[model samples]
Target: MAQIAVDSSPKKKNFLRSPYMLTIALLPIILAAWWLATTVTKSVPAILLPTPESVWIAFPRVLGADGFGDQVLRTLTEIAGGFALGASVGFFLGVLLSSSSRLRAAYLPFLSALEAIPTVILAPIIIAWIGFGIEGKILQAAIACFYAVFITTLSGLGLAEPNAVALMKSLRASKWQTMVKLRIPTALPVIFGGLQLGATTAIIGAIVSEFIGATGGLGYLMLRYRSSFDTAAYWVIIFLFLVIGLVVYLTIWYIEKRFVFWRRIEVTRPDLEKQ
Candidate 1:
């Protein structure tokens, strides 16, 4: 007689799944929706609402060698340059303000005033001062990005609990030592939040500047296509904006995941823990 064997192992599901797989799964559904809308619709004219295939075909013309690729490159360069300058300056100022009460009180009002100024409205003035080249775009992006990082960093600097700071002082830690050992780590989540916000705003700032006056970029490309009534190409430029925003958000998200991994607050479910 054969004996039955018993096996016991925990059944586990992976929650950290790849986003690419999800995108692939949704592709078919999206295609079906697009096909039905374009093929079976008398609700609207085709010229007003073109098919997904038309948009897809136009994408190559918009992004290919003869199209908007060079423009995209120029925009990327301006955004990157601007964001780097803004984030660096903001981070340093944030650290300084956090460490000194006098400095915080002295400069915070000025910072707030800077933020209150609508940078987008000043595009023409910026162009007048810096010209329509990369400089104006960089300045625009930098100013917007500065506010994002600055505000977030200020919040992060104060996020540490009072008790934690007291304990550090009780241990006879120097101000700098306490900052490095306790405060900065506690601020990681908040700082990362600022970085994400800044990165996103940088893109918007760059695009807005490009729109005001640009020789190249999706903004310029859209303008060219619109003048010629190439609405398909116009839509393609809009698609490029969506892609650029998604890419910027994702890149910062990846960086946050890497640096702030240790800062996660673990939530324990009583029922699960009891089991």
Candidate 2:
């Protein structure tokens, strides 16, 4: 009998397939295009679209004497507070609604109506009632987040497998146990999906509130810069806003990846020997 030898080899990583690499690659092209538009061709007026170097130079001034750092901190704090309040209320309400059909039927219409009204419209009223401070901004963010979280959470809870519920019931599991052991875990993916949307909406709400009325925040900073026609500083502030939004989104994405591990796709590497 002849013996056959098997070879095992590691596959080479495809650098171009990496999402991070692709994103990083795109940045230089975007910057070049922006530079060409602003500097070379001068298609857009300098007053409107300042060069990248101007924005870069404005960063230190914006961060230092302009108090841009403080404004960022203020906005972040408002987002955090509002998100916490909204998430708490939404989660509890969703649980209540899911557990009680009668309550769900009675209150869902009202909740939907509230959600239908644009959150930006409420910003003025909130500012007037609570004053142009972090509190009002927080309330606006909370209101913006509330509806999305509530609706998604309710939908998630409803989507829990009926067979699992029946099994829990047959096992004499208490309502609380059923929720903790079955419903919540089942609903986590959808709930996190809602949370992602809520985080974005919360940021938008805070900014809108600040735009309506605020002593300090990025939105207010943008308004001040726009009025002065200091386009460089305006772009810098816009960049900071983008950073903040990216951070919020990435944070939630990280949480989802960690806690919702079961939903992650499994990547299998092919065996070179088999091939």
Candidate 3:
């Protein structure tokens, strides 16, 4: 499946060049470098970076621990809630503003100012307002997500064919009909592009918000592990972050494949033996 994205050449391709194999190869290669540096050479101390074995053990320990699931659920909820809230608003507002030049001129600068501020900068303020609850993290995530989708929606709606729009107007189509039949379909690909980006952005926002102040969550757990010098546990959280980002990203990508199926173009590269 991974190879399908990378190997588009209409010729015999090296099996070793397959992305699936190359990606899997990263593990042993990294482990070997890590083992050599820490276990063999002692050049990198365990206190700063734990051995792979330690991290391997920590994964099971972390997963099997009581309440670990609760913390993970809290984090996931914050990310999902934030994304849902932000994306919904962004899509609606994008439609509204794009419907009129006056609306865009009236509100675009304010939105631009909000987008200028990073979610990290808002973390402390959000926590203070919401009192370290998951709500604050969700707000942070929402902030992180809003601009990407909004801009993409604007870009997409603007891309509707001029002739098609003129035809709609000539046919006395209502704004809603025009949007449903033409504008939204045109905008979906671009909007989904924003959504794909938001999948990971929401994670960063939630995690950083948790860092500011939180009772539980992966970010809080990492901070706790750091204070206690639990290096392996810290690494486990790092890996969890990576995993969460990838899962969300792939989910959005799959959904995009469905909704925007027309955008996909397969270029066949038949086996050289068959040729």
**Regarding TM-score, does 1 or 2 come out ahead?**
2
The lDDT of each candidate is 0.80, 0.86, 0.87
Which of candidates 2 and 3 reaches a greater lDDT? Answer: 3
CA RMSD (A), model 1: 6.5
Candidate 2 lDDT for residue 270: 38
lDDT of 3 by residue, 161-264 (tens): 88899999999999999999999998888999999887678888899888878999999998998999999999999999989888898899898989887554
Each model's Cα RMSD = 6.5, 5.7, 6.0
lDDT of 1 by residue, 212-250 (tens): 888787777778887887777787878778888888889
Worst 10 residues of 3 by lDDT: 264-273
Which candidate has the highest lDDT of all?
3
Q: C-alpha displacement of 183 in model 2, angstroms?
A: 0.5
Clashing pairs in 3: none
As for TM-score, the candidate ahead, 2 or 3, is 2
TM-score on alpha carbons, each prediction: 0.81, 0.89, 0.88
Candidate 2 runs further than 4 Å off: 1-15, 265-275
Q: Which stretches of candidate 1 lie over 4 Å from their true place?
A: 1-39, 45-48, 65-67, 265-275
